[model samples]
Target: MSAPEGPTFRELAVQALSSVQHGYDLLAPKFDHTGYRTPASVLDSVTGALRGLGPFGSGLDVCCGTGAGMGVLRQVCRERITGVDFSAGMLAEGRARTPVAPDAPRTDWVRADVRALPFGPVFDLAVSFGAFGHFLPRELPGLFAQVHSVLRPGGTFAFPIGAPARPGSRHYWELLAFDTAMRVRNALWRPRFVMYYRTFRLAEVREELLRAGFEVELRALEELGRRADGSPRCRLVVATRPV
Candidate 1:
């Protein structure tokens, strides 16, 4: 069957007003149809960069959403792969789409918040995509610590970070407008939908990772190319727990 169509503006409005889990549950079926799912190119670039670092025994996709990141983990991890998210609706949709294959890494789905992951140091790698914007800046340290705690010694927690939106671009204004609307929404609403496009700065993220005891390194996904100032257009942050 063909994938479902994307959500309309009213549908998106309803989603924005609901709590995050409920919003995602309502959005799950049409998520991939929207441009919101991690782009395939980003996924491939991340996979390519992580190839030599793994043969990873087990992997986790934190806030796994509809399981796009799990496909990347399935390629690299040898033993097990799991996707965890707080929304049952999203997990159900993911389970339906995910194919099971012989010799495929074992796959499991758990419904849990990333801030309070319920696992030991069992995974050799963990990843998240596009979900960081949901987390407030204050929550990042705890979130990073949770991911770090679930990873074995020397295990890597990796994710892609794009260069900040250029100040004069349409993309910049779009993000600025989105953030302003979110601020206004939060001020007027009881349960704020906590999505912001601008809060997850690379420098702030790097500092939080360090404070959470991760040793972080960044490698440009050069296939994505560089910006006008010679800075990379995109980079993958590989944060490792000490062995």
Candidate 2:
């Protein structure tokens, strides 16, 4: 995919050296310009898939950086939409850009950690996009449980999951090098920035959702096309908080 408009090299370097919260805050003004934002194609595919399941009441966008998922919720949820993340600057940028139509659900931007979301069983749907790499695998159970706790029984938490990069592929090596660099940087730095492309294993994530009391399902996103092996390039993982 093409890269989004983003920050400069020196700016990125400064952000990378800072703490995660501060780093994102520094990048927030130009975040949408960055490739870190979720792609419109993925968002559209999810919006299409969720349309069949919907006419939902309220929705939450977990770890919403710049409100792409919030826009998705606006299309489907009838009552309210909330975007939660710990980064104050990201929330500010999201609020500035993600305006609701007069006919759309009312929107709220919350600054809170996704691991400890501050909501009860009030939402009929929750979604996140392109935010999983920021979370370590070990924290997923608690994280999924937090999402589960905020959803009404039978509510769904959905996100796009791409096929793992094949070993020795260009993408695979790029991710490997990036993760290695991140590990080294974190080891030598204070207040680690936790992001690893390889850590969000689908099987492990499905198991964690199950342990969090979610019945999981995966639906191919046909719009994104297929891999060389004919498997879907990306699948939307829908985990329901069972009633």
Candidate 3:
């Protein structure tokens, strides 16, 4: 499913007017059809990169909207895989679509905020995709700490970060305009829906990961190709909890 089958403009407008949680709830059923779901190519690229880094035992996907990251976990993890999200509607969609078969490793769905992950040092690997923009930069220290707390010693936390949109490019201006509108809407609105395209800079994220006690390394996801200057289009950040 793609844009042609996705929500209408009016439907999207109603969703944008709603609170974040409620908005996703309204969007969940049609999410797979929307452009918002991370592309399978990106997921495949990350999974390929993580394969060399793991034979991870148990995996967790934080903010696992509709379980897009679950297939990645299924490929790498040996024992169990879980996806956690605050949106019950998203979780329900994920559950309905989860491709578990007889003898497959257990897949669990938990509804919880990623800022306050609900587990101990049990998972051997954790991942998140396309969700960080929802978090304020100030929330990252605590958020990274929470992810750190949930990983077993030496466990990996990985996610993909794309290069910032080029200045003066159509993409850049589009994001700037969208963010401007969102800021104005939030200022005038009741329930603030936090989503920003330009907030999660790689440098700041790396610093916060270090502060959270992660040993961070970044590897290019070459499958996504490189930019004009030869920089990777996307880099996968692999942060490991200390042994």
Candidate 4:
């Protein structure tokens, strides 16, 4: 269910019709109220997971929409934190929502496409949340390459991914219907809005990350619990640039 303060159906419809960047810009104000924003529970779980591996220095949040990942970076990173995305509106909201405390690390926001990050090997850690659905499977190689390029040798790139919905489940059908609708909408629309729930699978993603020269590890987010088959319902993908 959507939050009472979240966007109305009409607002969501308008956003769905716009390009990804523009749609996010239009949705930025009400984004945190929507179910689209990463949940606090997930953020806290990630913080707990990364805390064990970290005490990292500078950190980056890729495709940071309204600063959810920035909050995670704040706890894990000691030196500085940067949030990057193509949407100015979303960045503005992020900045407003996440004010820098006197003792907090220096925070910066950069406007650029993640496909070609403008930084060198600078960050010690990086994290992203709920944003991977925008990229097609074929783009994973280049996307992971870009992420790999921006991290210092031995720096970590981490993100959470949910297990695929079980076949015939309500969630499975919901996701299938959503992707189908998006495909149809894109075929008929001018500026295509790209977002699909089913495209990012772990096996294909692991291969791409390996091809991009990162040592990969999977840690179950036990806080999220397990499936009936005893597999983790959510797992953290930890990819580290080689030292």
Q: What TM-score against the true fold does each predicted structure earn?
A: 0.97, 0.97, 0.98, 0.99
Off by over 4 Å in 2: 1-5
lDDT tens per residue, model 1, 1-243: 113578888898899998888999999988888888998999999999989788799999999999999999999999999999999999999999988799899999999988999999999999999999999999998999999999999999999999999999999999999899999999999688999989999999999999999999999999899998999999999999999
Off by over 4 Å in 3: none
Q: Give the top-scoring candidate (lDDT).
A: 4
Tens-digit lDDT string for candidate 3 (48-106)? 99899888999999999999999899999989999999999999999999985886679
Residue 80, candidate 4: Cα error in Å is 0.4
Assess candidate 2 and give its lDDT: 0.91
Clash number for candidate 2? 1
Inter-residue clash pairs, candidate 2: 5-33
Q: In model 1, which residue pairs have backbone atoms overlapping below 3 Å?
A: none
> Would you list the rank order by lDDT, best first?
4, 3, 1, 2
What's the CA error at residue 209 for candidate 1, in Å? Answer: 0.6
Q: Which digits, one per residue and each the tens of the lDDT, describe model 4 over residues 37-69? A: 888878988999999999999999999989999
lDDT of prediction 4: 0.95
Error of 3 at 91 (Å): 0.1
